[model samples]
Target: MTTAREVLDRCDALAACSDAPERLDRAHLTPALARAHGLVAGWMAEAGLRTWRDQAGNLCGRTEGREPGLPALLLGSHLDTVPDAGRYDGMLGVLLGIAVAQRLRDEVPTWPCALEVVGFTDEEGARFGTALMGSRALAGTWDDAWWDLRDASGTTVAQAARDFGLDPGLVGTAARRPQDLVAYLEAHIEQGPLLEAADRSLGVVTTIAGARRFLVEVVGEARHAGGTPYPRRRDALVGAAEAIVLVERTVRGSDAIATVGRIEVEPGAVNVIPGRAVFTVDLRAATDDARDAMRDTLLAGIAQVCAARGLGMRVTDLYEAPATPCADRLRDALRAGVVATGDAAPLDVWSRAGHDGMAVSAVTDVGMLFVRCHDGISHHPAEAVREVDVAAALDAFTAAVRTVGATAGSGATVRSGATVGSGA
Candidate 1:
């Protein structure tokens, strides 16, 4: 069986496969990502899984069950990451999937459910300006327009895929039919402070938060700073400053989380009055209704602010993704696994972050298990996980798969609960 220590060590090795020698910057479909895939495919093969890379550039490993034709339990997470990423964000989940497969390889031949693990090619959208590209393609939701999206280097996704030896025209071949899967399960880092604050090693994800993002622009006249009086000047920067504050004030006491992570000002000079200010608003909530309502309220309030300040404002909707909830049976299996590990009541969390599971849910039911990371820091170099917690997570993850396999045979339907070995 693959130990958690080995997995962490391998992560350190893969950390070297970056576009920049000084940082972990493995973007999708790049030469650096190809190196990463090579290393992971070897590990998958060693786990006794038949390995292959999909048309969309996702790496997959598969094995049969007691007999051929069993619905497969797909396990995995994205292999790609944000620039300067922490090794464990998406990387840890994919490695854990491999670890679980290695532990169960000898036992799966007698079980009814087949096993497959995937290391998704893109989840961070750091390359092609489209998130969940791999999972969406696998889920059969690929948007043809995404092919035109270009990276900072002006490489279109189609060109990048060609460079990576994948046929962009046949990317749809990577899609899987809904009937082909029992369900999709991913074990990922908590990426937040909840689990750490609770002093827990694992948590069950209730739902992935739905989000609406916009690029808001405030327009005002640019004038000489010394010549323009305070009353006569239309200051876009001041309007933006008020708008950012309003975003916080509007969502302050609510469950919704809002952030203005980026902003740009025109005529960015000390002597020139700003002509325009552009910023981003990312709002997320546990439910679609709540998120949409919060969005409506926030946007309307911002409009009022713009009107009162005598500034022209516009909002360009960047993206929107609805909430994806975990299937009941999968949640139960994960809960049983956690309970078996001595936590009778698994803490439930609403993911404030987005995940590939949201896209994968289009084709099959999706579930997630979150393992605690130190200080809940992610998308950075300092992200770390303990070997003990990983060992626990491995046990829980393997047991969870076993629980589902027992009930997901050719003719069997997955029931709410089942016993896996001595884990009840």
Candidate 2:
């Protein structure tokens, strides 16, 4: 079998200058990410796999098995990254799939099913404001509404699709029939410090956290900061401060988490009292019920703070995705794989910040494996993962692949269909 270090090295070489702003900004499949996609496709073809681009621009490489009609096992992760994102985020999964293909190249005959490695486009949503665009299409979840989504330059997703040589009208062809895919698995970095703090080598995610987003706007009368008496001032910033505290309290009261990630004040001048404030609230929990409770608590707290401050407020939901449970069989397979390597560590715990696996889980039996990242920092240029730990994760993943491949139709893929999108 190919080593994890080798796999990682290959991916690094391919994406060495990808999406680098100086080389054609990689965000939103800008020319840079598209070039990276082309490079990956070239590598896949060289590896002796049949490669093609789906209607949604998902680059797929297939390794055929003895049974052409059997459902294929899908391995995927997005290739696009946030602005200046680290290389390992989505590239590792695709490279690992390539390693799997290399392993089977000269092996004996009679494979049970096919292997498909997909490099999904636009998972970061950094530029487009819509995450998992590629996976959503594969899951048959994208609609015309997404066509209107524009980036900072007012470039629509539809326009981007055309710019990259993909047919915008054929986007629906990316969706697969249930019978076409047996299961899906993704390997990614933990993107957090939990695994490193726990001294673990692998993290078999139990549930991808449920998330709810809200845009809060607070309005108040503007006044001159120097001319207006402090008592007479109607400051939106002051009201926003109170709302932030309430948001903290609301999340702290339950087993949920919340953050006011972005905030803006109108007439942002030191000499003027703020007239309005806008902020986004991101809340996450292990279940929909917990998430709903947290949302309600936050809303009530915001209303109370607004009423006390005599400020007008409005709350709008951007989007909400319920919690998704990882497949039990797949989880067990991963555990076994880790144990087989003799470096198996106890399962690490943490909520995922963002991942494409969440979207795939909505439609099929999907599992995730996370390798510990250095200092738990991600979405930055300095993000790093230990090479040795990554190798261990690869071993664990390879074992899981073998187990799933060997036990193709033993009901493992069937028992967990309900858990894919079930919030529990």
Give the best candidate by TM-score: 1
Off-target runs (Cα >4 Å) in candidate 2 are 19-25, 104-109, 252-254, 343-345, 348-350, 415-424
Give TM per candidate: 0.94, 0.91
Provide the lDDT at 227 for model 1. 98
Per-residue lDDT over 303-340 for candidate 1, one digit per residue giving the tens place of the 0 to 100 score: 88888878999999999999998887788889989988
TM-score of model number 2? 0.91
lDDT of 2 at 124: 83
TM-score of model 1 (CA atoms): 0.94
lDDT of 2 by residue, 1-424 (tens): 6787787777677556565544323565577767777788877876677899898878898877676656677887878877767777788778877776666654312556677889888788888888888888898888789889998889898898899888999998998766676678888888878788878877888777899989999999888988998778778999999999888976787778899999999999889999999999999987789889888878888888888878999988998987877777777877787787685455834355667777777567777888888998877777787778878877787778777766666554533343222211
